[model samples]
Target chain A: MQAQLIALDWGTSSLRAYKLGPAGAVLEQRSLACGIMHLPIEPRDIAGIYCTNGFELAFDTACGDWLDAQPGLPVIACGMVGSAQGWSEAAYRNTPVDVASLGQALHCVRSLRGVDVHIVPGVIEQVGLPNVMRGEETQVVGVLQGLGTQVLIGLPGSHSKWVEVIEGRITHFDTFMTGELFAVLSKHSILGRTQQPCDQFQAEAFDRGVQVALSKDGQRGVLSTLFSARTLGLTAELSPDQQPDYLSGLLIGHELAGLPDHARHKPIILVGAAPLCARYQRALALCGFAHVSLAQEATERGLWQLAVAAGLTQPVTEA
Target chain B: MQAQLIALDWGTSSLRAYKLGPAGAVLEQRSLACGIMHLPIEPRDIAGIYCTNGFELAFDTACGDWLDAQPGLPVIACGMVGSAQGWSEAAYRNTPVDVASLGQALHCVRSLRGVDVHIVPGVIEQVGLPNVMRGEETQVVGVLQGLGTQVLIGLPGSHSKWVEVIEGRITHFDTFMTGELFAVLSKHSILGRTQQPCDQFQAEAFDRGVQVALSKDGQRGVLSTLFSARTLGLTAELSPDQQPDYLSGLLIGHELAGLPDHARHKPIILVGAAPLCARYQRALALCGFAHVSLAQEATERGLWQLAVAAGLTQPVTEA
Candidate 1:
């Protein structure tokens, strides 16, 4: 019997699923906003359709029937579904993750209907570091396979991750919460009161903030420095457009200040959305990091590649 | 003829008005929550009862009222009333303040009722630095008078001020947004979702957070260290009770980390509400500044001294 391959990259707000042939070629692609948060309790019947015909068909209407039609297909899932609050915790495999040695760490979960469901395992790193990426790791590994070795991939979001790949092996990485900070500061701080929606980043303010971060006084003493942002803006000492940029610079500056000095010289590849990723690249350049590039659809692309490697998908050919 | 003295310490949330005898004795004290935010767009005649009495009252009401009631008594106002959003911007008076020189800063102005009012100038210091205190200089001067000589006075609030006084002179000071950071983090961050009402800070967690802040890594990169609070809490590594302490540690840690080396040797005096001041003192002790003291009514007392120097009222017996 020929087996169909289904790949899923599900996260907090959305989900992307793909169907592939044996050779890992994409046969069809589908996506939905039905993240883990939207799923109904005891959604076994609905979830079954998600694994087979994709979200185009109503999961609630024909999930069971769709599952029956694709009885022999193998399903692979990644992303937040592995979280404690998601489908179930996908037990993590500790780093350094050897792509070839990587195993299909699937949790054979039994749904409310007693149907067996397998969920992929997440990768855990830096025992003391409180960050764990589920779906993104698969994509990172896939990127390594697609673009041969020695790349630094930055996955930016509420919790931004920078993954290091050396010779096709997932070596080490770090996580920074820049996105979340922006959200909090823009909405909660005194800065929030005066902040307006403008894309302009005051280069001068960013430089000054970076200089402050680099000061012998250091970024660790930054809380007191935030008041300077207001002073700089209101008093015309710091340009208004620069407040956001200054905030970004301070955050990025601290990130650099805390980093192991060795990480500074490495070739960097930013894997996230534009504007923000561009901003990180700009800051890194200011900090003297010379080599940096960006990757598009890193998460989805990584998911598809991982699904293929897991013997669950076909290789895609140009349409 | 008898002269009445009035002093007002107007902060963001509440207005504290003191009726003082000529000798700087507290005759009566009253407080109201009608802060600047509660004031009407146009000033109102709200002092009908007190003015009806024969005794002159030195209350820090609206600027207009202070002017209207000016000729009869000396009115000294301190605190946020000097910020740009307040009645007027008081240029910061730098440290090593000569209270004798400060006493000469009284300005005469015509009131709305054609009365002559004496407006005390807000002192400015360290012209280039963002460091400035409007009313706090008077309070710090009072603290110096009451405590004698060199001391570190930490005033905690929406904007926490750390002032260093040397030999009765205000040397230098810095401000930290501890209270504001706590409020923002508790009400707006991802951590806020898990926050419970934290009326009394959990000492253990606060201590632990202080330790975290004391980390070589923590101090060097605190701007980034904030994320650890969320990660630690969300991962359940840190208890919910520890959130506030962690936050307090972040703020206090940054303060301790950024403090000028000179402040380390000075005896610390905390000036604020009982609970918060005590907490700050405790945090300071943990940070190795063990010699700490608390000042009650530092704001009110500071206001009185400034009021007396302005000759708002004649010396009366100590109440």
Candidate 2:
């Protein structure tokens, strides 16, 4: 039987873990609604456990029982589990780390039940730019392993990250809180309640916001752009759906405004959710990034690769 | 006993009305906790009579009989009262309007019986720089009279306003949603609830934030600056109280970064709550602004001044 390797991607709103075979294929995938952000700080409180559909307990019980059933198996973890409030802050290893070097002993420790556990070290790009990354380090490695060339990877989400890979090593990176800005703007700014959830195209307002973002004078600061959405709506000019897109344009525009000097002509690969990934692809294309493409579920795939590097899974060719 | 004109400044959370004598003196002042935002859409639902302890019930009963006494008023209104939910919106007279020429005639028709109502026109400066103002226009005029200035003025609040006054004439103005950014950054950003409220000077984390804001690089989009506050607190060895202030500094710094050039050299006047006002005052001084000072309840006094201008009160000699 193939040995078991556990790979997890713990996000703010969801938890996803995959049990991998020795050949690195997913034997079974499990997820729970319990994210670290929702957990009560008081360890005694089981509120997250109760609200979650038996996933956390089941994960622990099943993994523990499986380990008992078969001794000498090791499980490795990554993602928000390594954040300060997570399992523990996975001390960052400064970048330019080789995939072979990532073999350095994973954050190995014993669980409450005395089960041997290994947590991956989140990468910190402190040399050129002061940025921290957890699961994406594995994703960059995976992309590098698959691509076999220097690449510009755009990891989009609450905090969209961009990393530079040269010769299978992550040279440098920066974290832009793009996705986070969209969340606050949509949920708390004056335009918060007005952002209707939809995938429909808000071509018009987005164009306007993009124009503003592209302007030399307008891109100075984006906080002012939010008020325009309210005023435009009040004046019967902007539609409800357009509000989110307009805000998206403003944020993406600001992000683009600060793009690294080398990024203008670089090959852009997006790694995140579908709509957002698509939006970044389009925004970059508008900014003359013609080689833009999507990197699907790179975070999860990244964690799995880290598992392999941690000696939890056997290396297999990317499908 | 010349007929006194009562000036009301009713908004989302507070209701304040002023009793103006034939000679513009604050003969009496009354305030209530109920604001229009707290009331439901139905007019009848807002008709009940309620008064605070200090208010005379008999006098309230008479006023109640006059205008239903719940949310009672001397009657001229400004602020949110012009929104779709507040009193119906009064159309604006576009820019360069004389404080005397705001020509913001109230929607007298929206009042209940015996409530002779006039809701001021919310100013709209749509042409060049594009800005709209509702309640602040009246206050600007009042402060102008109070200070006897035909100079540039600033009003810092949820929306920081910059009004251009040339010889008692408001040439043009613009609005910046600065306070809203602070609220969103503190409550909704990834740093959500991480930076809790603390006394202004008592916290060192706040000073760190201010330093970050003053930093050349930290002056970029505030979203990026916000994450640093948590990072600094966790890694840089800062006290808890200072975290919130650092957040305030980043937000205020972002506001100052985008402030108009013309207003920077002018005598800057502030009109708002103390702490927020004080924060803006601090921001102005730090930004190399030469002259900055605060004005007392300028909006209320501005409304009172409007009453005098409308022949509702006789002008008093300069005190």
Worst 10 residues of 1 chain A by lDDT: A53-62
lDDT of model 2, residue A216: 56
* TM-score for the B chain of model 1: 0.82
TM-score attained by model 2? 0.84
lDDT of 1 by residue, A224-303 (tens): 76666666666566555567777777666656556566567766777666977777777777777777777765554555
Best by lDDT: 2
**What is candidate 1's lDDT per residue for B197-235, written digit by digit as tens?**
567767777776677777754644554566667667656
What DockQ, on C-alphas, does every prediction get?
0.45, 0.34
Cα deviation at B28, candidate 1, in Å, is 2.4
